[model samples]
Target: MKRGILLIAAMTANVLLSAARADEAAVRAEIVARLPESVGNIAITPDNQLIFSHHPFFSPEIRVAKLTSPTTFQPFPSAEWNTPRKGTYQYLDNVLGLRSDENGVVWIIDMGFRTNITPKLVGWNTRSDRLERIYYMPDPVTRTGSQPQDIVIDQKHRKFYIADENIGPGGDGSHAAIIIIDMDTGRARRVLDGDRSTIPEDLPITVDGKDLTVSAKDGKPSIIKVGCDGITMDVRSEWVYFAPLSGRSIYRVRVADLNDEKLTPPELSAKVERYSDKPNNGGLSIDYAGNLYLTAVESKLVGVIGADRKYSTYLSDAEMVWSDGITASADGYMYVSASQISAAAMFHGGKGENKAPYLIYRFKPLAAGYVSR
Candidate 1:
């Protein structure tokens, strides 16, 4: 009888151990607000505060919010300058792309051609109450009047790397170039121009027991599009890493050659290297150990690309579909916004509209220090 009791106790202990092993820790910051619209980009400041950008269709303009605390976020008191009259000169269209400098200045890029105008980029001063330094993308990167998607700022060099996906506006696979911006002089240059670095991947979905989707952007029964959605500078800042939503492979290139306009297209293409395999990935971030984090799209997970370029799950959950706008902090957390952007009408076979009320999430790269026996 004692042996039977001991066996039952051992089974119970094993079950509990397995459960603990499968558990994941929560972020210190909570999902305080589900924005009425989709927030596509985010950058964490040194002060532990989060500066985010958001906009709704046919909206007034892009709005910025500052997190007062981990669980609370409110608009930065820039009402006077963000208004239509005083701030009318700034980009009125989609501010989908944003990046912050080491000095804490935030750069906002307006895709300019959202409603009626052509695509362009803009800048903002985080130290000020409103967007004080707004400007258009300089010439080299805008040869074909390109579209700006994501940006990464280099504080040491006073430059910004802009990813021109060129697939916007019912896009038909236009130019694929990375624009290097000189913040001090407001100049921009095109690098890796017309290189086949990025390819399209279909948005795979299972609905009503079948793959229900159509290509609204391409007018075909497909979901793939040439993309350059998320970008970030590595810890060393020597190379830039990026991936596309429809891309099957991840690519990176040295910043030194990218900044130099003298390199030819084929030469620049040779410099490009495949980084990883990320489907439906909308964002890229790096940890202190050089592992790359990607939004695993339908996987509802984040995969870390190691130094060997081998991938592993840093964190994942079944509810993680449509994750977007991810960034890593020096402290150890890789923050990502959990927005089911793929389930949107546009992402499927319906209208190209994204559903709103987005949520933010954070995960620890190293196992939670205190979460063990």
Candidate 2:
């Protein structure tokens, strides 16, 4: 009978839908690593070697590490650099921004806030397992209210683009800008000071169905503000894209304009463009085919902005909370770390509630070749 056939077709469609979702879940994201609490950043080299950084905002142990296996990480370079008691001469202070270039070199931006330190860059040759170079930021540059949060390396041009989140000691984030460093000459420049694109307009950061706020001295929840947290460079190394963790928009500018010292900040600001509307996110990554990946912090999703500037949800999982650093690897995988920052004790009264075994996830990128590695 016609009615019986209709029922069978409906049942078949339901089965097919279930199968499709199961297939999607199969490759949603593989749990590549686990930690005790949270990590600030994650980078994978072209050879699929993993490197991660510990955010100075929390514990200072293991400022940088290399994944020997899925769950084990060895302090990258050595334990001295990760230990505060090792004396400040040849050790790392604070490292947040991390990147692995195509040449298998890992670059770290040490904010240098430990003891009395100088902000600098430490490059490690992964192939040789040795420190390659160190470039210290001049006093004038670091004094310009620098709070480097993330970095993007332009290997083709031998330059580095750093995002200054600008959150001060008192938890104020009014100052935000991009710092450019020349790898060849060790010269650094801060651009777009106080510009609209660099500054994060006050906005609520919601996570796990609750707005992330600051805990007052009296245990009251207050608004939390952050600026210019994530950044990335295009495939051709011609453009840079960035976004604020508390913001819902993505911005971009030409590298040519950023490198030109003759132009004033105001003039350079004019060259920056508001690229697209996005969700609150912690990291931005671009693939070689020009697709931009955003780590959606609130919705527990990974959003993608295609060449058309249209936003779409690429992956969604309940486990991805406070999805922090994201890296598009040349191996066709995009890796993300779930720091669960909003659940930390500082924001939840005096008691910390961060659960152990924090997770890192990775999925195949939309297209092939990634920008850096």
> What TM-score would each prediction reach against the true structure?
0.77, 0.88
Candidate 2 local lDDT, 1-373, one digit each (tens): 7534533554454344333332243448788888764777887887888888876668557888878876788898789777766435577778878888877888888887755577888888889888888878766666544678688988778889888887744435566778888989988887876678877778788765567676667878767777888899876688999977778789999989889989887798899999998888888887655667888877777887776677777787787877888997766678898887777777676687667687889888655546363
Per residue, candidate 1 scores C-alpha lDDT tens digits across 63-141 of 6566555445565435543443432554345555665665456666666654544445555555554555655664455
Q: For every model in order, what is the number of clashing pairs? A: 3, 1
Candidate 2 stretches with Cα past 4 Å from truth are 1-27, 85-88, 215-221, 371-373
Could you give me the TM-score of model 1 versus the true structure? 0.77
Lowest lDDT 10-residue stretch of candidate 1: 364-373
Error of 2 at 200 (Å): 1.1
State residue 38's C-alpha deviation in candidate 1, in Å.
2.4
Name the candidate that leads on TM-score. Answer: 2
Compute the lDDT of residue 194 as modeled in candidate 2. Answer: 63
